[model samples]
Target: MDAQQFLEEFGHIANAPGGVGKLRELILSLAFKGELCVPSNEISATLLDDIERQRLEFNGETRKQRLTRQSNTTTNLVGPYEIPKHWSWVSLSTVGHTWGQKKPEDSFVYIDVSSIDNKAGVLRQSPEVISASAAPSRARKVVKKGTLVYSTVRPYLLNIAIIDRDFDLEPIASTAFAIVHPWEGISGRYLYFYLRSPIFVRYVESVQIGMAYPAISDEKFYSGVVPLPPTEEQSRIVAKVDELMALCDKLEAQQQARRKLQNALRQSTLQAVASATSPHELQTTWACLADNFGRLFHEPEDVDDLVAELKNLAVRGLLSEASTTSPDLEAIKIDCAQMRARYIADGLIRRQKLVGMADCEETYPAHWAVTAFDEVAIVIGGVTKGRDLRGKQVMVCPYLSVANVQRGHFKLEGLKSIEIAADELAKYQVHEGDLLITEGGDWDKVGRTALWRGGVTNCLHQNHVFKARVPSKQLLNEWVELVFNSGVGRDYFAGASKQTTNLASINMTQLRSFALPIPPLIEQQRILSVLSELTKHCNEWCRQMERKQAMSTLLAGAVVSSLTGITIEQEEEPMKAPQTELVAPLRLGTTPDIKAQAPLATILARHHGEMSAKDLWQRFGGEIDAFYTQLKTEVAHGWILEPAPAEMREKLADSVSA
Candidate 1:
């Protein structure tokens, strides 16, 4: 069917998420049914004759022999009606020798599914030397130069490759394989496509065992029936599919580029807004962004970036530029001194060693007091645990675990319920407006703090949380939150932290010694109000971005389905055409199979004389892909980045030139 007609019939699939995947399945089913192409009179006549001859030959034998031959072909084909006219039902094994090779020895050249491109059905390479034990067995089948190999273990792996070079063959595959060598007029490429169809994959999955390691058996492999076309038509179908797949690849690339550009534009808009330094500047920035709201935001990530920028701006004192007058330092200091004296007299708080500093310069806002964090608030360590409690039955007390602490904030998702005696609840009960700081974690998060807004009435904290119960009458909780999240707090936390493996942590003493910039109570409230309003705005923008992202994802899937969708007619009809003739065998390259290589600098010069490291790595493909994947995972696990060599710049420059 033509593209336009196909779309008219199955257009709904194009608009749904994962619709393209369904379309691909439909196309494959139709292709096998011979409905993808129109049939000619001559081809139809010849196909009918071939079917009749086969039937006659079967009937000529004794009833027992005939039954056995039919069973060998397709046991479930109860009658000739099972196969359409001008169509023949035969096992794929009829075209190739099954279990053709036996292992000759312990070592020989070998190929694994990983070596093949699952997408293009081409063999990809690695440079690492394979262990002698891993070499294919001596008796493994020798695929002829034009034969195709499909990985049977993961039917969906779609690892099909056409053999070109005649290597001294070894028992190449694990028992999980169904190798196909086309007979005189058939095309291996066409057969490869047929095997990749979702219908075939579903057939494989139907019999596969084990959820974790699903696999199809060898017996099942040789039993499944396949649709075959004339040799010439097989070539035509193969060529058409290849051209269309390439077009799909180009479309995917374009979509990815568009998404990237959209993200960049969103980021730039956020940056521009954040650069505003005054109320007028901020108003101008807001106006520009408000005008282009639809254009600037498009995904959840963009909104997240904007939220981060808002947090940064809030801490930097840019969010409240309009009503943020100079803070009154003397008044704040007097108030803090009074509160500390009262706490000491009541013995409600401890007297900790505080950090002292010289008076600040004029640039230090006249209305803001600079003092050690201890003077403004008390910092205490969490209760010590005496033993491992993994399997113990404890009370279900709402408790904060180490994971609950974030950078100057708390995330309550996956909050754990701990076993604490009802009598001991008084000691750990969390109150509204009380700040909880992470006492031990990565250095950046060690001193992170968040105020509890009392989401739960009786939630208590765990031993890992250091509570800072501040007086709401004197201090603004939002102001404290902003300070703790700011860069100044980050630097102090980093400096006081002690490193162990991938983690860095701080003790209570570090928190007490940390300096803080305190503003007058009124000024703090003003700052808090302005920051709260602006952050809410940023949050709203983020939500819109997330919605857009969902839409984009849906759209992309729809487009993909449109390109690969199968039509209604193809599913019901089977076409007869001449078989495909192979004029040339597929080319397969041979290279060492090492998985890891020297640093990019060393490899760049050898591969591309003067190319950038990025360009050279892309050319290499496999090792670089593995390296980056590993690197990103390590980083996520909190490993620090090791410094790259200084010579990398020169190497990268040379690669760029090349």
Candidate 2:
């Protein structure tokens, strides 16, 4: 399609999921290919001559050095694509030379790589003025007005900008950049646009070395090819690109405003539904939502919010009719007491000192009785870590850690193993119909519980997890798990858990004392049955939303490919196979294989000290589950150390020195 046709169809593309970004890429691709503007009769001979004259007059020695450096990398030069007949394919160095580095004589404005806003193609923050002695070593390249600055490292980030005017103090940039001083022939804005093009980015990606800190060398960057249009044509192309980009900005703003309005409407509608005082009012509000569902719930997150509100309403007894039979509280209390006494008499559990329920602010149906969790089930703490088993014979068994436990579900992937003594196995082993709850992690994860249906054989849990087993059949494990995963349960856990920084934990005492609203067996089963059907519908709707989002993405890709004559199939190259190591593959639930642990151990040992989990992932570039599996195994064997807090690290250092 022609430029005008493309511009006209831009709205359609921009409205698709992730379409705006793809539209921007298409604009850049078209502009660089000389398809955005009509070809001119003007020749580039005069422009080239003028550029050479200006370069020679500015700094002859610098020009000579650039040429010498370019000569060495001549063999590495590769043309990205053929240019238009009216345009000339020339090296970037011919029209611009990188500015030389200079140490600051006094305090100067330091514009590091982080200072540039890649998306807006401008400086987001003011440069900092530091003393010459305090200046960072990387802050050595000097930028002047009209100079095009492009970061050499991680060129895919597209941290490229043109210095429009001079600063109050001399502006210095990080050595991570190659400061391009365009000669008379090149339009600085045009060069900046080209630098940000997908072709240039792909070229940089191909040549960039190192996975963690990919960068293009100065020689490679300077010697890269540029499609040079006539000087006047270059100006026209820059202006056209700017105008198109501004249109894209407006389109993006319109989309954002629409989304904001939708979100506001959604929140208000949901609030109305939640605040309904009667079933009739709720039905009316829900009917309104259903009528406008297509317009209101366009995004997957919108569906998620709706599902959450549904769950909240379900637990509040608003979703269905309350059972007519009144619960026999005295009979339930007697039965619970007798069950506890029988378990204690059989030596299956220890006799516990009970704590009275604190005054709770929440109210439930009259048919439901408010009681502590211990009244409904027995809460047991999981096996302790680092316990001495010197004389006790032990067997390796698969166990559930905090990672394995999620809200309402168990992640059976990468289930690790632990050594459990033969006699202590029964105490730690998880049984069917048990409710597994996590003790700590981030605050949101503190009270996450899931039902255990014997998915894994002989599965045990770590100390950070707690197990709640219902002694009587009156309460279902699914019902209890639903209660804990609901908003009411989340609020209780958030308020009751001991919070330190971002992490929170709940001890056995807190778990046992948790207040549970118990309904009669018949009512519980009725509520659960309705919840099961509604939840299934919600999940199916969410899956439909997911499929719609995927289709939108595919449609966007197809549009871009069709316009650029670049097939979508060609864009997606197969991912490189993961690097092989001498270590054997890890087998879940098996005894730790020394060979399997060797690669991870070797990697961690090479590092001086503890590293963040993010940094560790960058080094391996493997699947997240694989990385965590290795990490868990190493931690189990004490081959790698966990990260310590600042105070602890300082104390350890001082003790080591002494």
- Looking at model 2, which ten-residue stretch has the lowest summed lDDT? 643-652
Best by TM-score: 2
**Mind giving the per-residue lDDT tens digits that candidate 2 earns over 1-658?**
5557666766567877878888888888889878888888887666876876886687644755566445733422446565676677677777786667798989998888888889888876676788899999898887888888889988888888888767889989888888788887689999998898777877787788889988898878876778888988999999999998998888889999999999999998988887776668879999998898888888767877787777677667777777787666666667667877876786656888986664567777877788888776777778876778899998888989999899888998888888878787777889998889999899778899999988688889888999888766676677788888888788888888898989998888888888887777787787788777877887787777775665466556556755665433222223233332222222222223332323345444446444455455445444545666766666667665543321111123545658
Per-residue CA lDDT of candidate 1, range 416-503, in tens?
Answer: 6766555555557777777788766755557677888788756776667787755435567667777776655666676678888878
- Which residue runs does candidate 1 get wrong by more than 4 Å? 1-72, 75-97, 100-104, 109-121, 127-171, 176-186, 202-225, 321-351, 356-372, 383-399, 406-431, 438-450, 453-466, 482-658
User: Whose lDDT is greatest here?
Assistant: 2
What TM-score, over all chains together, does every model reach?
Answer: 0.62, 0.77
Cα error of candidate 2 at position 154, Å: 2.7
Lowest lDDT block of 10, candidate 1: 566-575
